[model samples]
Target: MDYEAGTYQKLPIKQYPARELGETAEGRYWRRFLSPATAKQAGAVNYLEFCPVRPYNLAVTSSTRVLVYDGATRSLHRTINRFKDKAYSASWRADGKLLVAGGQDGIVQLFDVGSRSLLRQFKAHKRPVHVARFDPGRMHVLSGGDDATVRWWDVSEGKQVSRWEGHSDYVRAAAVNPAAHGTWATGGYDHVCKVWDARSAQSVLSVDHGAPIEAVAFFPSGSVLVTAGGTQVRVWDLFGGGRELACLSNHQKTVTCVTVSPNAGPDSSAAPRLLTGALDGHLKASVREGVYELERFQVTHIQKYPGPILSLGLSGDAGLLAVGLADGTLTVRKHAKPRADPAKAGILVGRRSRRAPALTAATYRYFIRGQSSKAAAKDSVIAAERKAALATHDKFLRKFRYRDALDAALSTRRAEVVASVVEELAARGGLSSALSSRDAAGLGPLLDHMRRNINDPRHAPQLAALAHRLLDVYGGSEALTGMLPALTLLLERVELELRAQDGLTRVQGMLGPLLAASVGAC
Candidate 1:
């Protein structure tokens, strides 16, 4: 009977400090929304909105026009270019039948989505109208403009319903409260945000946001308010008399837009998610309920853009995400379908094949019956099933060739492999034989490795012992005495390393007492 050779044993891998990984749930969730579709516009994309009704047609407002995209195909469905000057905001009604937008020409226009005809146009603002949104009842529209005023217009009457002129500067941001009728908020360049009731002309609530506010939003319950301004997104407790709940200052530049994800809930059982876009080219999703123990808000999702993000929008179902950038790029991401389990899919295919008619040569699957019948194993499974190939040094070690093993390890130019081989040779009492009869050229590689790795703490002791052994074997030989300069440099490196370690030790000792005192004080 013949015996197979034993497998070569691998060296013990050196251990290092383990690095901690952060939460991956958000990363995995956001990664599922793949297959991005992008469109180029004529100018900076300033606004993006998805229709609330099904098949969620997207509305993109750029320079002089608002382009409505077919939700199913993501193709341009309608182009409304009736503006005399640049258009600013394009808003969709709750029923998705009417579209309203404000323009730099100080005109607010409403259009019937089905007919693509202008139904009404209000021209009351003296300056550019920056924001226009429909009220919850769909009977009135609210608009804010650079004229430092917020106005409400009635669709049936085709005239202004009310005007509130409290803002000291340009009124750029406005949002209607979803849970409350006749309630809405407006933000302005005066760094103030005010909530108003349509029943009265006077403002009902007010808060100073400290910076020119760009965007504002109301929580689903209409109890919490969010404001985005210079690099900060603030959450306010409306029920608590407009007290600041959390000040999220994560962005490095001005936050241009903020919106609440439709999936967010009002109760604590489901944490609300806030999406903010900034001029720093980052879109961040933050959770109002704390994710970490001590953090007030946790930014869970982060996506980068090619240019400054000007506007962002999500569908009512949170299935589609749209981002508008300053560089005339509009990117839309649709949620991907979940993949079916492999075993279930295989079972379904097998059932179909068993009940089907005979395969024909004209069919594409007829020629490929054997090609994909057997599923390929995963990489981890394949690695577990296959044996590892031995290296040159490992092969020599199996044959009890210690000197050849050491030579092979040195030839590979890896300090860890060379150290492992030298340690093995020393254990087998073949270190002397491996170091014997080597000239200057043959020994250059070994000396160079020692010079490079003599100070590495992992292999320091082994290399030092080998260095002592080499000195003992070649100290008195005339052939090796000519290499004094190389040995001197090695000695200098060891001394320099020793000095560095001593300085670190002394500094640690000095810091120990200070750290202890600080801890005790805390």
Candidate 2:
């Protein structure tokens, strides 16, 4: 159907089923999985981090252990145990060979991924360490703790090189500047986000977010910073006098974690995308162009979990997204880009091919004869078969053979024929008998057709009647289990529409008396 040039095509709602609906291409970019619970004990997942380099293993911290799983397969590769207390903030070094984690025992532990051995342990803080990360150079580690101090440690010596004591509350968020040497950022319960340069003993910049900061991260270019707190994710431009660039407030609860893709940038061809997780079990991904504007930061996708989101991690290539939940469910989703449909493109090519030919008359005639004969013959055969099938279908309908008519219409998969057969059966009061006698195997296609057209205004009453009869016969059978979700969703929508219609009728009745009273008063 033709529409205004800038308008989008209005797709029929019935064309998309509950299982096949998504903001992006359905079934292309997203999938859900519940990680094997046997590998890790029952506890809230604390953090999830993917390796920065090759193999892209995922580290999941829960209870007292850190579990590593293959990124592609989600199979448990190894379990790093021996934590004296609950573990939190599992991070990977740049090389992907080492891992660092902070725990409730007031210690920072490092593990060698290749050997699965404890490489070093630093008794770095007086209280539990809440967040940790490796510096850009990988020579030192940065950690924040409940002791209200940001400490730096030399990995080789396993000793604290320096510490920054400024925040008066627990430091729960930290990140290393990817583009700047000797620079890092941190946020804490003190409601402040601070940026520090290692060359100096004090913070170089500070911003008051007006709420307790829960997570902080730097843009890939290191020219801007993102901080999450109470339901808001804010971006600041470091090079532009630390100007507040954008405030993204999409979550309904406290924002728990945030991460950015490594390839995201302001000047690159791809728009920079940000991923944020909140305590309300909502994960949102937003994108912005090079020109930073408050209204330009648009939400692209949102995924819901069963429990509060505790941690979020984006793969280095931005192809995989890992999410951890408070209910101990870990989900990994792969990002997919929609590909152009070759069938539609071929149709467009055929349309354009109808213009005048560029070849000589003799050449065109020769090629046309070679192609047209086979194509014409194939088209003629298909047309003849369709005509015969329609004749047979019409003969059954004329004789009031609804059962055979329905079978023929279903085989053709034509909406008009199917709807006519169903309507006719319902009008004749034979819907229940016709549907109930069919075997379970044959009932699937018929039920699917009913589900799709049940809410359509012209045929809703008849389709709904047919649906109830089918459910009555097959609701308890195992064969219907695979179709249960779709059927349930359709029925729920029908119920909602019926309630809405009832409410509208009541409103119209009340308005009639009010209108009459107003006329009398006038």
TM-score of each: 0.64, 0.60
Q: RMSD in Å for candidate 2, one decimal?
A: 14.6
The lDDT, on a scale of 0 to 1, for candidate 2 is 0.76
Candidate 1 lDDT over residue span 157-270, tens digit each: 999988997999999899888888788899999999999998785698999898999999998878889999998888888888898778887898999999997573211223
What TM-score would you give candidate 2 relative to the actual structure? Answer: 0.60
How many pairs of residues in model 2 come into backbone collision?
0
Name the candidate that leads on TM-score: 1
Off by over 4 Å in 2: 1-41, 264-270, 289-295, 335-522
TM-score of 1: 0.64
| Top candidate when judged by lDDT against the true structure | 1
Clashes of each: 0, 0
Off by over 4 Å in 1: 1-18, 264-271, 291-295, 340-522
